[model samples]
Target: MLNILRSHRISRFAVIGGASTLVYAVCALALSRGGTGAAMLPATAASVVAYAIAGLFSYAGHKYFTFMSAGAHAFELPRFALLNAMGLATAIALPVVLTERLGMPAAIPIVLTCIVVPLVNYIVLRRWVFRDV
Candidate 1:
């Protein structure tokens, strides 16, 4: 009963979340690449831009595919955006604290963002942002 629904929901969430992750990684890595030339950006800056793009994809995917939400976009979108902004803040801060302050490689924060953001998002998205209506 509840377990079945939860299992099905988890699978759908994985599909959409995976896509969003791919979008974030591609954009972040691409933007972070190249030489010190103007075309390149610092890892944290690239991550910020990439996450913004990925967040939009995630909202659409989670709305239609993951949660199959039928709720009003006006209501759902604002909440969804707020949830993602928290994730974004964490994503932005990780590099600042980890790479800049601690002198860890940028990859560490980038990898942490990939793993941590989705985990937190799933919990919040299921319970709050895209809760069953």
Candidate 2:
């Protein structure tokens, strides 16, 4: 347990993931609420936009910091983007299926999306996207 707690990659992931999640959650909530001068967006729309914004940060952080991989960007970048596209799909679909179809609140879908994306992403990033690490 202590060894697990001391893992360098996990430590880096926690820092990077926290920052990226903050970006995602803030954008999502703001867009959903139409904060400032922005027009209100549906939960699904907000999520897609948020995921796109966050994906960039996540990619750079995971590639350079968390995984510390020396793999060619040409190979890794498309794989990273593809994985994030999968994450974005989850971010979009959770709101549609949970809030629209099941009558749950927008908040629930957003929170669930936040939880699911990172867990799945970490596994895939290790196994495929940043496999060289």
Each model's lDDT comes to: 0.85, 0.84
Residue pairs with backbone overlap in model 1: none
Judge candidate 1 at residue 36 and give its lDDT.
Answer: 34
**Which whole-number lDDT from 0 to 100 does residue 88 have in model 1?**
91
How do the residues 1-133 of candidate 2 rate in per-residue lDDT, one tens digit apiece? 7677449788898888888888998898888863224438877898889889999999999999998889999999999989998888899889899867886767787788888888898888889998854
Give a tens-digit lDDT track for model 1, residues 1-133. 9999889889998988888888888887778762133537787898899999999999998999888899998888999989999989987998889867887766677788989999999999988888767
Clashing residue pairs, candidate 2?
none
Least lDDT summed over 10 consecutive residues: which range in candidate 2? 31-40
The clash numbers for all candidates, in the given order, read 0, 0
